[model samples]
Target: MTHPDTRRPSSLTAKLAGLACLLTLAPLQANDRLGPINITAAREAPAIAPAMPETVITREEIERSQARSITDLLAGRAGLTVSNEGGPGKLSSVSIWGQSANRTAVFLDGVRIGSVSAGQSYLEHIPLEQIERIEIVRGPRSGQWGADAGGGVIQIFTREGTEDGSHLSGGIGAGSRSQREADAHIGARQGAFDYSLGVAHRETDGFDACENGGPYTPPCYADEPDNDGYQRDSLQLQAGYRFGEGGHVRVHVLAASAEVEYDGPTNNSEIEQRTIGLSASTGRIGFWQLRTRAGRHIDDQDYFRDRHFDSRFDTQRDTLSLANDFFLGPSTTLTLGADQTDDKLSSTTDYVEDARRNRGLFAQINTRLGERLDVQAALRRDFNEQFGTANTGSLDLAYRLDDAWTLTAGHGTSFNVPSFNLLYYPPYCIVPGLCFATANPDLEPERTRTSRAGVTWTRGPWAIEATAFRSSADDLISSPPPSYVPENVSEATIRGAELAAGWTTDKWSARTSLTYLSTESEATGEPLPKQPRWSGRLTVDRQLGAFSLGTTLRGRSGSENDNQGYVVADLRGSYRVAPDWRIEARVDNVFDRDYEVVDGFYQAPRGVFVSLRYGR
Candidate 1:
């Protein structure tokens, strides 16, 4: 491991030194009245179960925070870690509970969005303006989602036209380091048809460069002569049509393009992707539901180096699902479902043309043990053409202790198959004669067992929650020695605890969270890479008259690996200039912490942005 010189301005150091001053001098306003958090976006029917440890960020929160990207809104959440390879629009990755980025599944309206070829999800392309809400389910969800559910699931639901009225909203903003953004959205709903369209563009210059200078000679420096920065543009369209009363069809389309500049052997690279999906749901039979969906994705990547090499990756998937719910009695319910998926991938890089099919059947029983206790058990069996078969199950229990306290626990098993790149990519020499990459075609799927127990307390206008969780993974996939292909590592483990509390009053609100994690590779006896032991965040918002002010403090511990600890503060303010218009300003990285989320990557410096948002 090496230490890279993160070139930051002197003003950044001063800001860090004055953190205590800023916190004390800032006015402490009274709390603002806020409604309780709710998860209405989930497909499962709502129940008055025990209060669980969870957080919800609504559309209003997104607007007030003025997040530059989707990752910004997710960065400081409990038990989460983010790694970025370039600037704002560059490639970024996130992990939960020490699991790698690829182990976490991302979904848009229940449709998987990651690239099947690389097993990576691009968070920078999603336009926040089009998002309604984000539901983050922490812990294992293998029984419900199948593969890549070992870590957790991030479900993003786009906005839909409501009964209020047709609306249009847009904004433009400019920040430090040549960062700029433009976004717009339009939506309308008629008698039986609803439609929405959105577009966004972002560009940034990034930070200065640094070079690799260490015993490992790992390219650790950020300074590159040709480091130009990154740019991204995205467009999305969605429409839904409703028939008589029991059926509806929805269509979604998304396109994104990004260009990132790296400072190492690889030159600038451009990535472009397009996705189209069609889904239809019907409820004609008694207590029966049927859903069918088809999706296609095209990914193109161009590399700029000696001789130009271009690669194009394309994938198509079709799914059919049917479920029936049986109400045996007043206190018991049973659900049975069957699902099947057909996937195909094609590439121009001389790689293997792969096709896979999956079929699964699942059943769940929800029962009320008594007036104060509830339990749910679910089991699923899946058969894959490439990975053979896997079985997963989950159990959830909730107990209401009193009016203010509740307890809950859950356990589950999940499995993930190897991605195409992990099994088919060509090995290349790193240092002349030393080959650094290898591939294996007979890799076993990774498996995980997850368990969580938590307690929640709600009293008056304050709510607090704490949870402890432990997960053990078997046959963990990793590249051991010189192999680029994944091998089944013996085992790995992650244990962590999270604490969150929020207080709301009449005109002000405050929330804070603390998370501690310990992750290790049982085989190598080394701490996991890029995972920090401690992270914390504090946020405060105040409203006076027609203006509001907010501040956030986020910090992370130094890595056990070769990374350093860094803390950043952010400030934001908004004014209601008119009934339908608002002006907002945000200052990010106020201390300009010279830190890197990834070991060998560049992070943006302190920046400022201001924008005006209007809607009708």
Candidate 2:
């Protein structure tokens, strides 16, 4: 299987197509109608919980899904499952309903991020043009996001500013694989202050990410078919200030860097990622309503092959959070939180634990009863200095059963920790390849218990949400091989069902989704590898008058190690070449299917793209 119909355009993809069109209309504060900040479904916003379901990927659906990472704007959204080993910024894996992929949990706007020697969070170097939104919350949030969370939680928001005036925007584009992009932005808000700044660039000319399998498995056994390219650059900054009245102070920064060319044996890799934050809020403090945050996260990696130097992995994370919300009436609300984390690692191979520290204390309550009911509860406790105490909890409810219908239920608990390459990989390995991998200091930590049940329906504009879930995993973690190390006996039973539907008018809009999953292995009952027991999604959009159009469809079924089942389609359009200017186009894999979610890599067959714009 080889594909690469044409290639040219690498003078760094024409210097990233002269980047700057504010990286295709960067949406710093995209007309703020309250988009991001749902805090992955918890902390505040009336404490959240209608059987916990939150997923917002806006930025106008990432420019109507012209996506190129953030794992192509969250693979299949909501019922989450994204896997990539090749194609565009490579090396990715995400699974949330059936868990695994480091048991999910990632954050940016609220600090968290990843890698204390691989506990996840690379989302292929996160940069969908300095992003403007994304918030996902699946299940089990370790009470308030401590440890890995057992599968749920993702938050990313960058680019913010715009409360009043002062703006200058930009954009630029190109496509196919020779794909280049550019961006730039500027923002303002006078009186109390507000700021935004942006820069973005993307480059491509990639294909042939891996193959030549067998003999010892895992990517390249040689036959390097050329063409494995990628490049990225990013920067984002946001500022804030508001005094007296309801006080506020905020600051943000996001940085990204990348380089790629792959097919194993470290054929080239270099990445740098950073997220920093500082936040403050207040509401006269007396009856309480406060928020505080301080954060830092960085993940740097480097590897090279043939051109010399071959290893380095670095990660640093520092965070602090504090919250206090109490609105005893108006439907009730109460929240109290505390969190601190510090994880450190720097390597050139040789890990036996580079560092760790975690502290958590959480409490939550959300209310409203009588008029159709709604409730929420949460509790958490954690302390770790290299894995020690843990306790988590959650409870949720909702009941309306009328004006359409509503019913929900939930329960949660979670844990997962054991990465430092699963307890110290390569602390020492010697002799003719005696260590392709090894580590497992009596590993243990993977405890979860989750439950959910739901129903929601609306009458007008049509809307619906359905959920069913179950999860049980205990001490599950395996490494397998002649000596891959990592072990913890194993036990898992994941179950899932999800459905979503939407419809709108005032220029048409549509959405759909469905999924069902089951992963097992209570001691080899098998079935659990690269998920997908069934999946589906569809999207449609339109907005005539200034013109706009969209289409999307996705399907899946098959996996217990790639059983073969596929479908993919996409199309997008836009035009408004006046008063603010715009023009856009896209078509990716539109019927050019030959799929594999990952099994010898290879994806991306049909493509076409175009872009140009200025100001929203």
TM-score (C-alpha) between model 1 and the true structure: 0.87
lDDT of 2 at 46: 37
| lDDT (tens digit, per residue) of candidate 2 on 149-206 | 6788887888677657877776898988889888887878888898899898888888
Best by TM-score: 1
Residue 161 in model 2: shift from native, Å? 34
1-616 in candidate 1: lDDT tens per residue?
A: 1111011111101112322321211111112111342232122322222233345567777887788778888775777787655566556667877787778877776566676666657677677877877766677766766677778777777777765458898888887878888889888989889988889888877664434443224443223444457788888888998885357898988788887665544446677777777777664445455656566655666655333653456655555566565556566657677777676667664556477788888877767787778776778899988888999988877787887777889888998888776677555333356444445677788999989998766677677767889989998877643232467889998888887677767687777766777887899986666677776667888998789999988766655443565677899998989988888899988887776665555566778998888873
Off by over 4 Å in 1: 1-53, 209-217, 220-223, 242-247, 284-286, 310-319, 327-333, 429-434, 480-485
The Cα RMSD in angstroms, rounded to one decimal, for candidate 2 relative to the true structure is 22.6
TM-score of 2: 0.32
True-structure Cα RMSD, model 1: 5.4
- Residue 266 CA error for candidate 2 (Å)? 16
